[model samples]
Target chain A: MAEMNRFTRDHEWARRDGELVRVGISDYAQDALGDIVFVELPQPGRRVAAGEAVAEVESTKTVSSVMAPVAGEVVEVNAALASQPETINRDPFAAGWLFALRPVRVAELDDLLDETEYRKYVEELSR
Target chain B: MLRTPLFGAHEHLKARLTEFAGWEMPLSYSGVAAEHRAVRESSGVFDLCHMGRLVLEGTGVAPVLERLAPSRIATLRPGRARYTVILNGDGGIVDDVIVTRESDTRYHLCVNAVNRERVVDLLRKTADGGDTRVADLTLETAQIAVQGPDSAELVRPLLAGADFPAYMHTVRGEWEGQEIVVSRTGYTGELGVELFLPAAAAPSLWQRLVEEAVPCGLGARDTLRLEAGYPLYGHELTESVTPVAAGIGWVVDWSRSDLPARARLERDRKAPEQLLCGFSLSAPGVPRDGFPVFLDGRSVGVVTSGNMGISVGHGIGMTWLPAAHTDPGNAIEIEIRGRRIPAVVEQPPFYTRGTVRQSVD
Candidate 1:
């Protein structure tokens, strides 16, 4: 069975498939950022703590950081985004996934917000 | 927050709004990149009512303006416009403006929004003992700009009995019984016209033009102007920057004997310590304002304005560098987010396929 998705306050979303986790920015974050012009993804084999910046997203208006939602070691990065950053704007959930990580602490998954809580939190921010 | 006449129109289009110079204005409509491409490929209409407009009339207006600005206003013929700069006693630029000679004794001045009140106050103080009368018409007037290759085709049918004026020329015409001033002047380095009409007529005019052209916003405006190498008010120009160092010395009339900052400008004309130059990055990151520029690993300058040139497809910027380092082909680096990206100085107008000088006939 596929693990359910979780979110962080910084707008990053993570989905676990067995021991590996896929991370990307939420749709709300991409919509607020307008057109994504360039993105700098973290290198594979790098380790990051929760809430640490692992990538950057630049738009015509400004630049924003894509933080790690949980402590993990990066296993693979989305190499296609370096040439086509707009993918994140077009498809923030599936093809736009930034990287896959192997979590160091499996128990930390419970600390993230689920879909229901993330939806409520995002609604409050828009208001 | 201040709102222009077309504020409702922008809202109807679902534009992303942002605060600019105390006014709530559209930053983009559909998207910044798409709007920017529209202007380059075809035409785009912009609501520029947020800019300040002032009218000066009376027999001595020309002389009064000549005294307050560096341009030779007295020599400007009717229906012609001159781009000039207001200067302080120390040769620092107070503001850059476009003065249009409507008649022998009447002139129209377009200034930056942030500097409107200051310019009006200075003009009033200067006209105190003179025959000129200064009136601030910013609130009552609405300004619109139609720019790009297809601008003439888009605007020609809207007016009656007046041909599109030559570059830097102005003409008066009637549109639906309302009188308007049309000038063949723009900041986008494209063939374009600026329309100055009453505020009440702005919304309908904007609506009509939007039917034929893409509606652009401030986000695209900034990118377009940067690609054209135009100097923005607070960026490339400032209270401490003189026209000589800003690479716009031609606008200053050095032969005018009684100009306010003529002597100081002449003294600094030969060897300005720093000069404005254009550069493009070889790396991927975008160079932004306040980014440090380096030469041989030593910090030498700072970027004043920068963007990912939508047309050029690279990172482009303008910066103030020492006189010796302002030449084209000179290699430099811009420090962005603690990483030094390789760059090279180049001639301005990074996107050179502009149609601003193309003849309409």
Candidate 2:
């Protein structure tokens, strides 16, 4: 759990680091997707641009693309959820993180969303 | 988003809703795999209120119907339903329907939800018999497909001593004091019963079946039908495609010299270009509609319908291919996210072991 974090309306989270921000799918994404049966992770060393499709997680019924929030280098991944996909639907925030990053720019969090803003964004989607 | 009569019931049970044929339907309530397996091994019921039903009455019924439809309507006996395609004069399919001749003058027609209005309009204009009349009965009626290996066994307890035959058959029976039309037919290739009853009685009927033999949503219904080698309307069976090309040549009767479409269907025999084939992926990939299908590095066609086969417990799919490579055991590839994964063409009802037709002694 890091401070000054932001979430995209499309259900992606980013936490600011020194020069890079870590990225992963948000709690709402996993909840809507149900139990994640399979996940095709982005290559760890590759660079991804903002709004670009970087990964895929497939449930039994549908397969969804996880978009990159900010331009970044994928440095880490949650391999635990790769094998145990139920963790995503059960506990999406802590143990069920999708992937992390070595961001191209940390200030891009300004373009992302804070906790209150993200909550309102998710609220509008439900409507 | 259009809602079915059972929409409130689905919400109450906390079902996962998804858009289907312009109507909001439950994908699953508990789990797709669980519901699918339940229907395969035991029995499960589906709320089929979204499908369209129509009733036609008055004299000259068969004559009015014969002009529009490609099948011979005059040959149908009372209380018997015949599956036919209403063809465009040039010989393209409009939609597939089950027309039951209730009497010499009265008839009942069932059409898919998407093409219900289109089918009715086609019949209205083409039907020239002055004595015939048509009325849309979709809202007034509701049907439930209680299907599986144990479908007949479990539903027999509910019905009052009526037996049904194999595919494309129907029987009338009573359930809970209301006379019901119980048909031994279903889209899923299983020996199941489709119950046609009143609209108001649907919720209770669904409740009883769910309590008795596990309630199934559209998710299981889809997977079950796909595994059964049945062609869905928009996907495998389309207006642009003929029944012969869709792996359902058995439904088309070419012996009738009176029907002009017989000559049109024969033209396909001289030069058959597209052929439907069944596919299976051994590793881990589920092909979907619009996904590219390949054979020998050439893109032959696209996937029609696919899902995890509950009986076989593997990913199975159907796709159209060039007749040259449509043979069973021919190697093909499905382009899954740009990766050409190897697959093989297998004759469908991908699960070989199911009791669709009871053995006759």
Provide the TM-score for each candidate, comma-separated: 0.96, 0.83
Candidate 2 lDDT over residue span B58-175, tens digit each: 8767777776665778888877778777677655677788888767788888888888889888777766547778888888878888878888777776658655545666677766
The lDDT for every candidate, in the order shown, is 0.89, 0.76
> Docking category for candidate 2?
acceptable
lDDT of 1 by residue, B197-267 (tens): 99999999999999989999999999999999889999999888889889898887777778677667776
Best-performing candidate as measured by TM-score: 1
Q: Which candidate leads in lDDT?
A: 1
Judged by DockQ, which candidate is best?
A: 1
lDDT of 2 by residue, A1-127 (tens): 5566589877888776555566667878876775466667788898888998888877667888888888888887777765566677777666766788787777777888888999898888889
Q: Which 10-residue window in model 1 chain B sums to the lowest lDDT?
A: B259-268
* Candidate 2 pairs with clashing backbones: none
DockQ, cand. 1: 0.69
